[model samples]
Target: MNNKTDFKTAQQFLVDNPDIEVIEVLLIDLNGVHRGKWIPRHKLQSVFEGDMRIALTGVTPDIWGRDVPSLCAKTGDGDGICVPTVRTLKRLPWLSRPTAQMYMHLTHQGEPWGYDPRVVLGQLQQRFAERGLIAVVAPELEFMLLSSERDAEGIPQVPQTRINGRSKVGGQLYGTDIMHEFADVLHEMREACDSMDLRLDTLVKELAPGQYELNQHHLGDALQAADNAQMLKRVIKGVAQKHGYVATFMPKPFAHVDGNGFHTHISVLDENGKNIFDDGTERGSQALRHAVAGLAATMSDLMLVFAPHRNSYRRFAAGTHTPIAPTWGYENRDVALRIPVGDPQARRIEHRVAGADANPYLVLSAILAGVLYGLDNKLEATEPASGGSHEQCRELAGDWLAATRDFEESTFVSEYLGAPFHEAMCAVKHFEQDEFNRTITPFEYDAYLITS
Candidate 1:
């Protein structure tokens, strides 16, 4: 494991940033949300001596930050410790005061936490390593920009909402002048990445208005790729706020625009640092096809991981690269999986399914699981289906009653995510669905309150 900076280094950080008062030790929970506690600068000394304690509810909570009472520690109960992942130490540039941040890994009684997303990814990576195959992953992250003006009550509100609001401001692919508003912040983000020593390849303004993408180039190990993906979000969000803007990785914040999607480009590499996808076979190697076949065959079953929410499913609408089906086409945006037209040396399958909101670890785990499934079962992608996953939304389990049926029915998912983790996720999601269903939105009241 790569852990940086012992107590001497950590204490030096305290001495170096004397103005800093708080340091947040965070961990990516099961839902991919960063959850942790704020510690005083004085605690920095003992960081290397031991781990930090956090509320147990974090591991099992849903994305809205809610946890089932039946499933988690009681309100104000503590359960485990987070061994500060020393390598993830970072400085927060957006806070009113100087602050440093670090991501954590959950452990209980000296064992990995069962519901820890990081653990899930870690174990899956080990499985891949055993097969003598490695995955290099570059997570393409997209997010929306919102003007920070709020209402009189200090409530937050997005200024330009609705279709054609921030959606159709004209697709400016690589329009730097237009993106100059965010340049200083983006540059600072670069500096922050440099400070933390995170490796990222390129940053570019994307197609949708106020949309941006950052690509991280890392491979030969699956867990590292996920860690990089997880860090990318944390770094960018912290840096974005320096420019008076709130950057969000929400899957579909707006109803009428191309929503944010995190396209993962993966290549199967050998121990010799060679790509297995290119064996010089006609139309690429069979391994490449089989890898994609594995993804396609199990796409729907992983919908809960890819889509993850009712709002997330909204992003799969036609026109955007997100595929409503499980189709694969060469550089075809219409397909669920688009094979980029380029040299085989850089050949990779662009998974167009994952929402920007999806958990990086979960997303990679699903992909790794699918690829491993293919390698293990010798699955072939002979009959690629078009629009393969629209059925996920169509068959909604009638109000969270059976939403996970497809994935639950999938023996492959059962094998990949393991039964316990899968059950935990499905249970949490069902609770979320129940919460949303019970709430009455303004539309319901406006449409029926006066007329009904």
Candidate 2:
């Protein structure tokens, strides 16, 4: 719900809808967490007057959701206006009372924050527009459905989104029967998406138990599309709560089996409004090859922006749709970049590097910028990737540190995202990495306390 309507207009609409009691405002902080204070409907006046100030901790800094350091809190706790983006205003269907929803973009001292991911994409979109190109993208998102309770082994469990209240057998392909189990959830999701102006195309049950997917429509504008991806997660989580269920886009919520992903499809249209990827020249257009080469060449460097979390790496298994190797193939699922089977007019690269948790704006920034680098450098993609996956891991980097190191050393990456931005992101990621590295995991304790 990034931009439902314009700012001034949305405010005026709320004024007209006097009966609309604004109960909550949603804001995505630097870490992509939703945070804001509750306000009464009458206080909507204060929101419009710029008197609304949310706490700083949500925006400034935190380690795994904790205020481990007070750096941000010391500076007004990173407080900012949950300034009404107005168009984000909506009725939260699940709240106990009438709840209206609006998502706020971040601003510091009334100027768009430079390092903000959303703003970062916005800047890139303007750059693309200058070159007479439009970047349109769609993400196929997948997530697991987990049991709301813990298991006998003290591990969290997952159950199907719906069980049809009866014992069932297996049916893998387009099993429409299972749709009934989760029809209610889908209905709510459709309503929420429509109200937010995000076009929804399809919903299907995925491979893993309780896992389901949502295929987003092709986005018209790049920046808005990324914002829509971020907003959809917020909406899904909010709506799930109403049904006494929890929805999370965390990349690898489960330890084993397949993890969630936001596989992106991207296309670049030229000034003449032609799909730049179209190549009837037989040997493949030089530009398209270069784009693929640039992507494969920079994937290691862009991993943090693509697969950020320690857990995110787990999703890149060979058998599953997620890719373990940084390679491309025509209409092939085995490679990281798949040219999906479709009409020639719809031909584009499908980037499989991202996890569900990756920031959409940042991911898009890395990708579109990488593609531009391809065009600039006139690079060429090499031979197809060797097929191997979770077991071999030869194609994918080993750990987050390795990915970060690769990203820092990338010439293509530094040239696009800029070294300062890259380094700043590295700094933040390293902070988390160090903290995680030093801590002993539950698995280590259970295995070592007496057995060793």
Top-lDDT candidate index: 1
Model 2 CA deviation exceeding 4 Å by range: 1-5, 15-17, 23-26, 39-60, 67-86, 108-111, 160-173, 280-284, 384-393, 409-414, 418-420
Colliding pairs, model 2? 5-87, 56-77, 56-78, 56-79, 145-210, 146-158, 147-158, 301-407
Q: What C-alpha lDDT does candidate 1 achieve relative to the native structure?
A: 0.73
Report the C-alpha lDDT of model 1 over 167-209, residue by residue, as the tens digit.
Answer: 4655477877766656677788878777767788898878776
- Candidate 2 per-residue lDDT over residues 1-452, each given as its tens digit: 23334645666756755666655666654456666777777676566666777654454343366542533434445666555656566665555566676665556687655445665677777778888888879977776555567777676555443443322233233666776666677688779888767777888876655667888888758767776787777677777766666676777766555667878898888988787887754234566788888888778778878888787777765576677667787766667787765666777888887888887778888888878778778887887554544433556675788888887777766567765356446656777788888999888999999998
Q: Estimate the Cα RMSD of every predicted model relative to the unseen true structure.
A: 4.0, 3.9
Instruction: Determine which window of 10 residues in candidate 2 has minimal summed lDDT.
Output: 164-173
lDDT of each: 0.73, 0.69
